[model samples]
Target: MKTADCDILILPGLAGSEEDHWQARWASRLPTARIVVQDDWHAPEPEAWRRRIAEAVAAARRPVILIAHSLGVVAAVEAAPDFPPDVVRGALLVALPDVEEAPDLPDSVRAFAPLPRDPLPFPSLLVASRTDPHCAYARAEDFAYAWGAQIVDAGDSGHINVASGHGPWPEGLMRLAGFLKTL
Candidate 1:
């Protein structure tokens, strides 16, 4: 479906997306896109994050398409089962951090350990970087296989965030546009 025909929910990771973050920029550019605000971004609570995502999907006037990064990707996968299959059309999951193996993981994020492995009910794509500090490429491939998502190799990009110099990532926008077309 065209972007105007759906609700694009941008789900940022811990600490939320800043003005320079790509997710924020994309949300601003897409008329139907909005950020899914969490109650606490610095101290993430898995259940709370999941509930917020569910609420956002529930409130969408049209089919929902999720654009998630880092920890937000984990929450989306965990909350997928709770969402009505017809409500969510697709998702673009980027930089999925391996919290289970991440050293010095914050207590808040550690609570979401052992990430869910169930296949999502809707179409999904997982984009991972070969040089991401948070997760290994192999692990990302494992996640794609388990979740039944198509995997996209994003070269050596680091975490694919603003800190990684992706504030106005046009290539990512193209990828998102492609994903949206399939829905």
Candidate 2:
């Protein structure tokens, strides 16, 4: 489906997407897009994050398309089963952090461990970086298989965030546009 026909919800990771973050930039560029505002960005609670995403989807005027990154990806997966199938048409999941194997993960993030393996109810694409510090390449592949998502290898793009020098991330925008076309 075309972007104008859907509500694009941007779900940012831990601490939220900053002004320079690609997710934020994408939200600005896409007139139909809006960020799913979480109550707490610094120390996320899984249930709360899930609730926020659900609320955003519920509030949308049209079918929703999720643009999620890092922890946001986890929250989306956890919340998907609860959402009405027709509410969410597709999702662009990026930089999924492997909290289960992340030794240095904060207590807040650790709560989302043992990542949801249930296949999503809608079409989705998972974009992963080979050198992402938060998740190993093999683990990301495992997630893609388990979640029933198409995987795109983003070579050496650390977490695919601002710190990784992906503020504009035109490549990601292109990929997102392509994914939207499939829906």
Candidate 3:
């Protein structure tokens, strides 16, 4: 489906995508996009994050498409069943952190470690880098397979975050656009 035909929700990671983050830029560029605002970006709570997404999806007036990154990806998965499957068509899930051994993360994120590996009900894509500081490619592939999502190898994108020099994230936007076009 075309972007204008769908309500695209942009979900950001842990501390929420900063101003310079790619997700932010993408949201600004897309007329139909809106960010899933969490109560607290500094200290995330999985349940709260999940609830916000569920409510957004439930209230959407048009066909919904999720464009999510990092912890936002986790929130989306946890809240997926809460949304009417027919309403939200698909998702572009990106940068899954290695929940297995993420000790340095904040308490909010640490609580989500060893996340559920269940398959997603709707069509989706999982984008990961080969040398991401947050997760290894092998684990990412494993999660993608378990989640039943097609994996997109993003090379050494370094968690695909703002700190990694993805200010504009034009390339990532192109990839996301390509994925949206397919839907």
lDDT of 2: 0.92
Per-residue lDDT of model 2, residues 23-123, tens digit only: 99889999999999998899899999998898888888899999999999999999997787689999999999998997667989989987989888899
TM-score of each: 0.98, 0.98, 0.95
Candidate 1 residues 57-156, lDDT tens each?
Answer: 9888998999999999999999888887699999999999998987756878889988998888888999999999889999999999999999999999
Each prediction's RMSD over C-alphas, in Å, is 0.8, 0.8, 1.3
Best by lDDT, which number? 1
In model 2, what is the error at residue 8, expressed in angstroms? 0.3
Clashing pairs in 3: 1-183
C-alpha lDDT score of every prediction, in listed order: 0.92, 0.92, 0.86
**Can you give the lDDT of residue 99 in candidate 1?**
86
TM-score of 3: 0.95
Ranking by lDDT: 1, 2, 3
Please identify model 2 stretches exceeding 4 Å from their true place: none
Give the runs in model 3 whose Cα sits over 4 Å from its true position: none
